[model samples]
Target chain A: MTTIADPKAPRPPKPRPARLTTRGNTELYGWVFMRASGVVLLVLIFGHLFVNLVAGEGVTAIDFGFVAGKWASPFWQVWDLLMLWLAMIHGTNGVRTIINDYAERDGVRLALKSALYLAFVLVVVLGTLVIFTFDPCPSGSPADLLPSFCTA
Target chain B: MPDALPASATRKVPAGTLYRGREGMWSWVAHRVTGVAIFFFLLVHVLDTSLVRISPEAYNDVIATYKNPIMGLGEAGLVAAIVFHAYNGIRIILVDFWSKGPKYQRVMLWVVMGLFVVTMAGFLPRHLMHVFGGE
Candidate 1:
């Protein structure tokens, strides 16, 4: 019996030595970010959940006053600041990977990434400002709605 | 798996669209769009919440401002932003680390969309009620 062979067939080539370049290695750096950020996110996110939800009186204990109490100290403020920065960087890098994969045109990719970077800067700056500048106990706040600690 | 095209085979083809540089595959593109949206939301949210630290009057003023119809809509937009950012972040994590990541991008996309819909559907009603207040 004769067997039929397919037309338009491809024959595989023997492997050749791979070239290494800075550009080729830059991709390695991005891959590193995915792993590194994933690890850090695991810690930062879980720590946030633990402090906000599990510590003290649990979920019911959270409210405006609770938030005010935490921000009353610089330590909690810095803790939250670190969390914000890490999560934003982690989340942004993850999305940047996605954009490069799907955005077909150079112009489209440039536009999208430019927008992403701008927004990232804006948030990080604004969030850091808020955390550092926050004054949870303003003297002039209304006695009724203000946290009790504010009056003292 | 065509053998490396002979120079002769490639030479005669009319130029198709010039290949763009910095080609991102697919998932990276989605990741970026969600990242930017979430970042913008974070900026506004932090700024708004920061008012609470200024004074109770200022905080109440900001909250009351959000009750305005346009601001109410903006809050809903924020909910959407967070949902997309979180869902896409999870997708990236799964794809990069797990053996199944490459295989599951399409399914993950659908899952993200579905969760986005459900989250907004649940969140918007409560938000609207808060903004509009009871009859």
Candidate 2:
């Protein structure tokens, strides 16, 4: 029987395969994120539009007084809170993917992303505080400036 | 369930620590965070605005509630969220369609920072005046 050469044999290992030249599998994941986040954004955005623009009196009915009314309830508070958290995460992730795909320099990537993270944290923290602490009325307010319901 | 969200399917395969590939991964994380924040604001705004349909009295009552100091803070927060989301969104759009992706990255970041500075500058003072009185 003729002997065959070992293809599996490790030789010089093919010139050590160039330094810092490896294209890792990170991009595949970014592409997947865009598709996923896009789908969720579609739902969140469309649902938001339909509810605000189509339901009830439509666009004309919107105003400052209208806003004060909804925050009075716990159900709506929670609904809004969830929407805020989900959309921010989705949108931020989408942008982050774009940054990684394009930015070539390591320093630039780190700096850009650091700023993004800081902005994200500030918004999310502030938003959550507003939802739960919101009150429909306040003490010692001017009668004329306050909503008409205060007189009742 | 038909109402079940579609985004969940794609996110299931968490690109956890096991998959360290390239710089693109960071971008994905940022996109997700921004999307989630925007979604939250929309839901709240829609519901808050929905109060108008109930009645003038109800609407007025709700508006009055928003006068609380804590609620005022929240409003400030909402404004902050909107401004940041919009600013960063512009940056993302530029990178996507523009020819100057890398070149503009730094510029775009500064723009976002500038926007935050301007927005907060206007928003904070106005909010304080509304809540605590200018005097």
Candidate 3:
């Protein structure tokens, strides 16, 4: 039998083999996530655009009252929440892969990825908070501008 | 990847253009470009949207900028990028998952482009009317 030395076999500590793939399935999952999230994002974003820019007065109708009316409903709130999370995650991962590819230097890649991740965290957190904690109608505000739902 | 070519490779091939393959490579490039553009816009958009928490006036004031003609044109372009990215993304998913995807990838790219044109055609006229309809 040919002697096949096991890489993980315990022996005297020697130089670790070059190009050892310690990252098992991480890249694979990232690839799969991109496609999966992408499929859903196409639907979510298309609907979002259609509603916000195609229906009603289109872009002209988008205002504080417009946003307030939509978010007031649990349905749209959940809808936006899903859109926010999925879009951010998908965009962040795509950017991260690009940074890894183009930023050749180790320090450069690290710095770029750090900035990318920071933006991801900041955007995701802020969006989530804004969606859930949003007060559609503040007290002592412009009554005329407020959505009718606020009066009710 | 910088290693030697295969045994049949005796001819001197052009360098630095390997990444610039035909339809597949260009589509990949477009995907990356659109993805990056959309990502930056999303960051700005999220920040603009977060202003809603500050006050209603703050939010409306910012969103009003988005209704101007210049921004209206920009929105059209953004929608174009989004439509292309969305359709191409579906094409990529099909290529990865479908059994007959590779055989028909070129056909699917055409399909993607076709869908993109039809979608933008539907969106642009109405959106431009809203923006420039002087309402």
Candidate 4:
């Protein structure tokens, strides 16, 4: 004969104690870095935008000459360099979090994260190089192709 | 006596319980929203800026499209999202690391909001001036 449980019975013990999955404080630091970088990025990003798109003649004013003019100043160079590095790293970490949450298979997660990290490094390196190494007035270029300032 | 059914199988969470608009819950939601927004913006921004390498005229032409008044308004919204996300993100970090953080999370959130307001107050006027000021 089957016996039914009483409604007034006490609860049973849990299966096992929960163990932490994350190692040391790495994830903790990652969490903190997200916040710190985010704060800095707001300033860097907005300043870059204001100067580029709104200052002077607004977006229509942006061109090779405009960028060359801005980068000519060491201030804008550093401003842009900080913005590029912080944003890329912050964004990569954010996506890593997303992948951890959504990706079920370990192999898939590893592959995706590896690809993401590779893209992060590629873009950051290339963008940094472009910002610093850009030459508005290269010798031997067709005069017609260069910005007016280069000739002046 | 027969064993009782597992709590997971028998218990039901009410819809209201799931939908309760707690402060921490909303903060998490905003974080995800802002993170995604910035990620997408970065993709388009990088692609557009890379146009500079192709030709100056191409880069300038692409950037010219951003001059629309409508886009200016959108930029304001984007700034607000970034500010909130950044401020709240700091609060989250504190809660994870600070000794007294979990106990004072609500207080920290207000502090973050206050800082956000101050920062926006300083930046918005200049930004608005530039946006509305004629070329």
Candidate 5:
């Protein structure tokens, strides 16, 4: 019987794979962050949902005045702010992974990731600003433009 | 089944016939789907919530549109997706980081699933109460 060559036999040294050249444990840390942030998001998102949709008059209670009242409290403000940041980053990273997996061409991957990052930055910045800088009652605004509680 | 097949037929295995029914594969699929769902929801959530920055009348009118019963069911679905995604995400993290995690990955999946059920059982009743109990 003719003997076949062993594929597992030791081979000559070759050049290092290019992937090893990339920087440190960023991806590893990101994986960890996804889990840690997920736990936090569970609490933050559910709390937000519970308060907005369940407590008191449920969905009908979530009027402009309702939001104004909630944001007036430091607790709600911080909770929302944390939720905004965590969810945005988590979602962005998730999409980035998907893009990397599906976008075979380097140019396409770069374009898609760039767009994702831009959207992430825009939403997070705008959402954070709206959360912290929101004024239930704007100075000199018409009474009709304000929430009922704001006029009161 | 292989024995019943003719030797020629058995020798020529069909292309693209490999079944991917592993727990890990299913978990990855769920993670991707749930991740996309959450991402899309975030987009809508940000847009709607930013209505607060606009005039109160605009914000109130937009929110008022979400008061329908159908929206309530949608909210429930969102919660379910979040719960499953979060639980599975934790499992993935453990598998990646813990030295012994890969060996126990299957066990961890079941654990995560169990926790998901328990958490949902606790939250869903309260949510339904608020949904159908009326104002």
Candidate 6:
């Protein structure tokens, strides 16, 4: 029995397109981050080099005193804090890419990445702690060895 | 997959361009090498810098060792590596984002090298003087 079909049937909504990658935009974001961080790091690092290595007396001037002097200021504390975080993240990602490239064996790649992540976490955490918790002067230390401001 | 199949056994006789790679490929290799070197250096640098938390004397003592002439020259090399990596990194960014960047990547590499030499020129003499000047 052939029956005439109704001309006014409603249509179903269109299905979403299949994802090209299961991992999504993670790699893309990583790529973008490298470039973005690379730009900022140029300024941070170049200024760092200029002050530390190219300034008056150069590397010879660096010591506990010099470091304490710098860190005593909130400005430099923040500078170093930013440098620490950004440089580590940027550097670690670069290494991760290299590992993915050369470490053909699965287990080797996994082992290498494990070690890398462990180092990254350790360094970042320790560095952040040292920066925030650092003391310009100790109670019993000889004042001569410390930054002059520490005694003053 | 065959262990016995050395390329000499095939008829191909190394005819094309010898695969030494041009500017783009070499720049990529250089960027990776310098990046790895900088990564390792950063690790050591952070560790050494952290010595300050222990005691002022401890930190100073470790840092003073770096003032020697040998380490001074090594520092120069380190700076050189960093400069190259930095400039090449900018080039890479341009290549990725700028529409005309791929066409001029070779030129950009030259520009990177040019800038690198200038920066090192400004840096080395000053640093070497500080290290060896004995003032």
TM-scores, one per candidate: 0.57, 0.43, 0.88, 0.71, 0.79, 0.87
Q: After superposing candidate 6 on the true structure, give the runs of residues whose Cα lies further than 4 Å from its correct spot.
A: A1-20, B1-20
Please give, for residues A11-104, the per-residue lDDT of candidate 6 as tens digits: 6667866974566789989999999999999999999999999887889889888999999999999999999999999999999999998898
Candidate 5 wrong stretches, greater than 4 Å: A1-20, A139-152, B1-20, B97-100, B125-135
Stretches of candidate 4 exceeding 4 Å from the true structure: A1-29, A39-43, A53-61, A105-115, A138-149, B1-20, B93-101, B114-135
lDDT for each residue of candidate 4 in A1-152, tens digit (9 for 90 to 100): 98898988988967775774755899888877887887788678767766765566655566667777777678887988888889999999998999998797999999999998888887887788878787777676566556677888
Best model number under lDDT: 6
Give the candidates in order of TM-score, highest first: 3, 6, 5, 4, 1, 2
- Give the runs in model 1 whose Cα sits over 4 Å from its true position: A1-20, A23-70, A73-79, A91-126, B1-30, B50-59
Q: On a 0 to 100 scale, what is the lDDT of residue A13 in model 1?
A: 75
lDDT for each candidate structure:
0.67, 0.60, 0.90, 0.77, 0.83, 0.91
Q: Model 3's CAPRI class?
A: medium
Per-residue alpha-carbon lDDT of candidate 1 for residues A22-54, written as tens digits (9 for 90 to 100)? 545767876776666656655665466457534
Where is model 3 chain A poorest over a 10-residue stretch in terms of lDDT?
A: A15-24
Ranked by lDDT, top first: 6, 3, 5, 4, 1, 2
DockQ of each candidate relative to the true complex:
0.16, 0.05, 0.75, 0.29, 0.47, 0.66
lDDT (Cα, 0-100) at B105 in candidate 4: 86
| Candidate 3 Cα misplacement greater than 4 A, ranges | A1-19, B1-14, B18-20
Comparing chain B with the reference, what is the TM-score for each candidate? Answer: 0.69, 0.71, 0.85, 0.83, 0.82, 0.84
Full ranking by DockQ: 3, 6, 5, 4, 1, 2
Among the numbered candidates, top TM-score falls to 3
TM-score of chain A of each: 0.73, 0.66, 0.86, 0.80, 0.83, 0.86
Model 6 lDDT tens row, B7-86:
66785445664356899989999999999999999999999999999999899889988879999998998899989999
Alpha-carbon interface RMSD of model 2? 11.5
Reference-based lDDT, residue B96, model 6: 91
Query: Across residues B77-107, which tens digit of lDDT does each residue of candidate 5 receive?
Result: 8878888897888788788789998999889
TM-score for candidate 4: 0.71
* Candidate with best DockQ: 3
